[model samples]
Target: MSKTEKISELKTNKTRKVAFMFNDELWQLFKQTCETNKTKPTWEIEKWILNYLDKNNALD
Candidate 1:
């Protein structure tokens, strides 16, 4: 019933972490655009991933 064991038992969801680097100015512009549209950067990245997968016929 320690903290580490409790943490391990709580991890019931499956999700992968996606990461990458971006140019400073371009990243700032992208964040500003998403903010103007009331969207988050993570949501935009997820949409881009889905579109890429569909375009490449990689989705199951």
Candidate 2:
């Protein structure tokens, strides 16, 4: 898909809420990293979780 389509999909699909506790300094760092990558922190965290699951063969 094109980048615009993907961005629209992300915007439309962010209808759910996920809550977690994040440390002050660490959360700031994560926010900066997400800004650097031009993505939301939630998306980055989702990618991290998916990668871990895939690497551990736990995606099934």
Candidate 3:
């Protein structure tokens, strides 16, 4: 398969939605962390949560 085909296959293989509640203070902290790390706040938070789950073997 072509690179695009492979990527598309991967994208279609799985999906999930994660929702949570956070106060303003927590959101500010997350935004600051993302800025300090030079990453988009939303993307960084999602990545962090995913990594945490993976490390804890909770992705099942």
Candidate 4:
């Protein structure tokens, strides 16, 4: 499938893109670590957010 098609599918699945600003060095290290662990940065961030919400009883 085409890249555009894949992106469209993601959008249709109710996923939204999020952007963040981070220290360059920290961002690089985090990305590299995730790569080394065979994981995506988004997955890690999602897990962290979910845990934070759950801990604070803020989940919907």
Candidate 5:
């Protein structure tokens, strides 16, 4: 198989780590919003980042 095919066939069971810092009030608000929506803040953030990347064509 070619490099592109090999790369495409690759799968990972690993997860990446990331960190962020924000205002205490903003964090509280974010937590509350996630709880009210019955979802996790991390999940919401991941969805938001994916949407943003897709909109900007950053994934390409």
Candidate 6:
């Protein structure tokens, strides 16, 4: 499949919600990081958590 097709396929999968809590200072830091990286902090953090879980095989 092409990149667009693969992305569309992924988009069709069910997504789960994950909530995070951080102090105001940490939140500001996260916002700055997101702005510098030109991406949503939440999405970046979620991807990081998923990668960590996959690497450790902890999701099972």
RMSD for each of the candidates: 9.9, 5.8, 5.8, 8.6, 5.5, 5.0
Descending-TM-score candidate ranking: 5, 4, 1, 2, 6, 3
Where model 6 places Cα greater than 4 Å from the true spot, the runs are 1-18, 58-60
> By lDDT, is 1 or 6 better?
1
Better of 3 and 4 by TM-score: 4
Write model 1 residue lDDT over 9-59, tens digit each, in one string. Answer: 434333767678999999999999999999999878866855776577555
| TM-score to native of every candidate shown | 0.68, 0.63, 0.46, 0.70, 0.70, 0.59
Candidate 3 at residue 26, lDDT? 89
Q: Write the per-residue lDDT of candidate 4 for residues 1-60, one digit (tens) a residue.
A: 654564445435755777899999999999999999999988788768657765775543
Error of 5 at 15 (Å): 1.8
lDDT of 6 by residue, 1-60 (tens): 654564445445648766778899999998999999899986677578667765786554
In order, the Cα lDDT scores of the candidates are 0.72, 0.74, 0.69, 0.74, 0.71, 0.71
**Per-residue lDDT of candidate 5, residues 1-60 (tens digit):** 654453343322226777899999999999999999999998788768657765786555
Candidate 4 stretches with Cα past 4 Å from truth are 1-13
Clashes of 5: 0
Clashing pairs in 3: none
Residue 8 CA displacement from its true place in model 4, Å: 20
Candidate 2 Cα misplacement greater than 4 A, ranges: 1-16
What lDDT score is found at residue 9 in candidate 6?
53
Backbone collision tally, model 4: 0
Q: Which lDDT tens digits does candidate 2 get at residues 1-60? A: 654565456556767787899899999998998899899987777778667765786554
lDDT of 3 at 59: 54
